[model samples]
Target: QGVVDPLGGINTLWPLFGIGNQMLASMALILGTVVLFKMKKQRYAWVTILPTVWLFITSMTAGWQKIFHEKPSIGFLAQANKFRKGLDEGVIIAPAKSVADMQTIVFSNQINAALCAFFMLVAVTMLISAFFVIRRALRSDLPTTHESVVTLRNKEVRHV
Candidate 1:
């Protein structure tokens, strides 16, 4: 059996992983903003709204770069194209042990690029859904989902 390299292709994987993680954080912040709106506290919603917007923008930008940038190190598609060119010329490029390794690298990069695109799509969908929910909450007098606060009377308290 051949031993697998634990760190192989990590350069391509790291950006995709980072984007996925940030997308999740962005989703949570969007949910927080929506909850604040539902509670009729639109003013305080900016606390979460700012982070949500920042995360969304940054994550999307990163994902876009990973998918489309020209540099092989920065873009998965670019890396894939580079390897494919090498494969077409029947040359084994650096970091690729053989023609088969070059083929695997090309396919791996393509998969990574697709994954990055998928993450971006999910993030956009979530942001759009949150926008509608927040708009509805602001325009309508929706009942709050939180429990009412109850104050205890001094007479109801027993001395230990």
Candidate 2:
């Protein structure tokens, strides 16, 4: 096994970064939900809740996988060195020489029809969700005035 390096450690941090991003997204979604609902716009609030709920779920799942699945394909640097050992003794092809190489081989075929379909499904769902939010935001019935005042001293101040 080679000596551990700083660059390798950084390479394993993508899951942590994903977890942080999802958490921030969840927080933003919650804030948006509250602000929109308090502003008396239920449609917009509902839009915010959809992604918030998804973000929370995905973050929790990532957290679980981080703690449980520490395999080379998942992110355990200590065990990664053994990944190439699992390859059968030479039949005709050379075994994956290293963990990173093996991981690439494992996932190299991932972009198949099923994966493409799943990606398309997710994209379509996102597009539909965005359309709803945009439509609600553009509705003329929604209140436009941030502040409204009525019955001032012999005058009226109204935000329109």
Candidate 3:
């Protein structure tokens, strides 16, 4: 689900590839927004951050649900667990539920792990970049500094 399908259609291309890259996509958007804030104005930053916030919230919520999801047919981990349980019980499980299926499960898990790591690294880079931007902004605003004045507060930036 795209969260708001009316705005745009949901993308199924990733599911076919066994990758859910929504979080990565959203984090990229957020990283771009952060960059825009630094290159543009702090006031504009506040406004631009709204969509990023929504994206972040939805991405995180969806990721959490997918990892701990209850549905066997939906979540990958759940599906794998169910298949394993079925195999252990010697019951017919998931279509072929055999060594091949186990291999696939392990492969899918590794892919998921790589995706998570990639996303985490990106998020950390964005956070660090944003931190530096914020620190620079704060440094320039010290009372002793004689730099061209720029207000940090949104209310004040509105007037600027």
Top lDDT prediction, candidate number: 1
Task: Estimate, for each residue in 1-160, the C-alpha lDDT of model 1 and write its tens digit.
Answer: 0122122845755666789999999999998888888878888888998988899899999889889999997888998899899989888888888877787788788888888898888889988998898888888786455545554773454321
Sort the predicted structures by TM-score, highest score first: 1, 3, 2
In candidate 2 the C-alpha lDDT for residue 43 amounts to 70
For model 1, the run of ten residues with the poorest summed lDDT? 1-10
Q: For each candidate, C-alpha RMSD in Å?
A: 5.5, 12.4, 10.0
Q: What's the C-alpha lDDT at position 117 in model 2?
A: 33
TM-score: model 1 vs. ground truth:
0.85
Clashes of 3: 0
Ranking by lDDT: 1, 3, 2
CA lDDT scores, all candidates in order: 0.81, 0.50, 0.52
- Candidate 1 achieves a global lDDT of 0.81
Encode model 3's per-residue lDDT on 1-160: one tens digit a residue: 2232211122212442233365566666666655555444456666557776776666656655445567854554666577567656766544444655554553454344345545645655776676686556545533222225456864444322
Model 2, span 23-109: residue lDDT tens:
667766765665564455667576888887788677656654544455644534323333324434322222445545555433332
**What range of 10 consecutive residues in model 3 has the weakest lDDT sum?**
4-13
**Error at 28, model 2, angstroms:** 0.6
What shift in Å separates residue 129 of candidate 3 from its native position after superposition? 4.7
Q: Model 2 TM-score?
A: 0.42
After superposing candidate 2, which stretches have Cα over 4 Å from the reference?
1-7, 70-160
Best TM-score among the predictions, by candidate number: 1
